[model samples]
Target: MTSPEEALQQARATYEEHARTCRQCHFDAVPCPVSKHLLRAYNNARREQMRANSGVR
Candidate 1:
């Protein structure tokens, strides 16, 4: 299993890469469907990492 930190890093990288290449994400106030999904994933990963650091389940 990937560590929480690694997972968060991967999720962040994926979201950042998509945001960089996706014109809709850059130009539109609302994110595109894929961008939304990626953002959710990144957020989830961040939360997981925080929980892990705090020793919470």
Candidate 2:
């Protein structure tokens, strides 16, 4: 079991890495808003899950 803080840190790092590449990827460019939304939701969910789990433990 990873500590909540550690898990959050890892999640943030991964999201940051994706953000760097997302802006430049042709697949992620202007025509697609879907990927951006998906990524946002994913990050939010991960953070929420971490918070919930952290609180419980």
Candidate 3:
């Protein structure tokens, strides 16, 4: 089972990768709000999955 911290870090890296591409696509324009939201959502999902798998109720 993956630790929550590891999962979260992985999620953050994914977000950062998207952010980089988004920034480039937009020419460093307005911040990528969607990417930020996605980051949080993914992290939350990972946490929930971890809890479910760990039988942590």
TM-score of each: 0.89, 0.44, 0.48
Q: Which candidate's lDDT is highest?
A: 1
In model 1, how large is the Cα lDDT of residue 42? 93
- Ranking under TM-score, best-scoring first? 1, 3, 2
lDDT of 1 by residue, 1-57 (tens): 999999999999999999888989877756899999999999999999999999999
Worst 10 residues of 3 by lDDT: 23-32
Candidate lDDT values, in order = 0.92, 0.61, 0.73
Regarding TM-score, does 1 or 3 come out ahead?
A: 1
Q: What order do candidates take by lDDT, descending? A: 1, 3, 2
User: What's each prediction's clash count?
Assistant: 0, 0, 0
lDDT of 2: 0.61
Best by TM-score: 1
Give the TM-score (vs. native) of candidate 3. Answer: 0.48
**Residue 49, candidate 1: alpha-carbon lDDT:** 96
Model 3 stretches astray by more than 4 angstroms:
1-31
Q: Which should have the higher TM-score, number 2 or number 3?
A: 3
User: How would you encode candidate 2's per-residue C-alpha lDDT over 1-57 as one tens digit per residue?
Assistant: 865566666766755566666755445455245446556755775776777877863
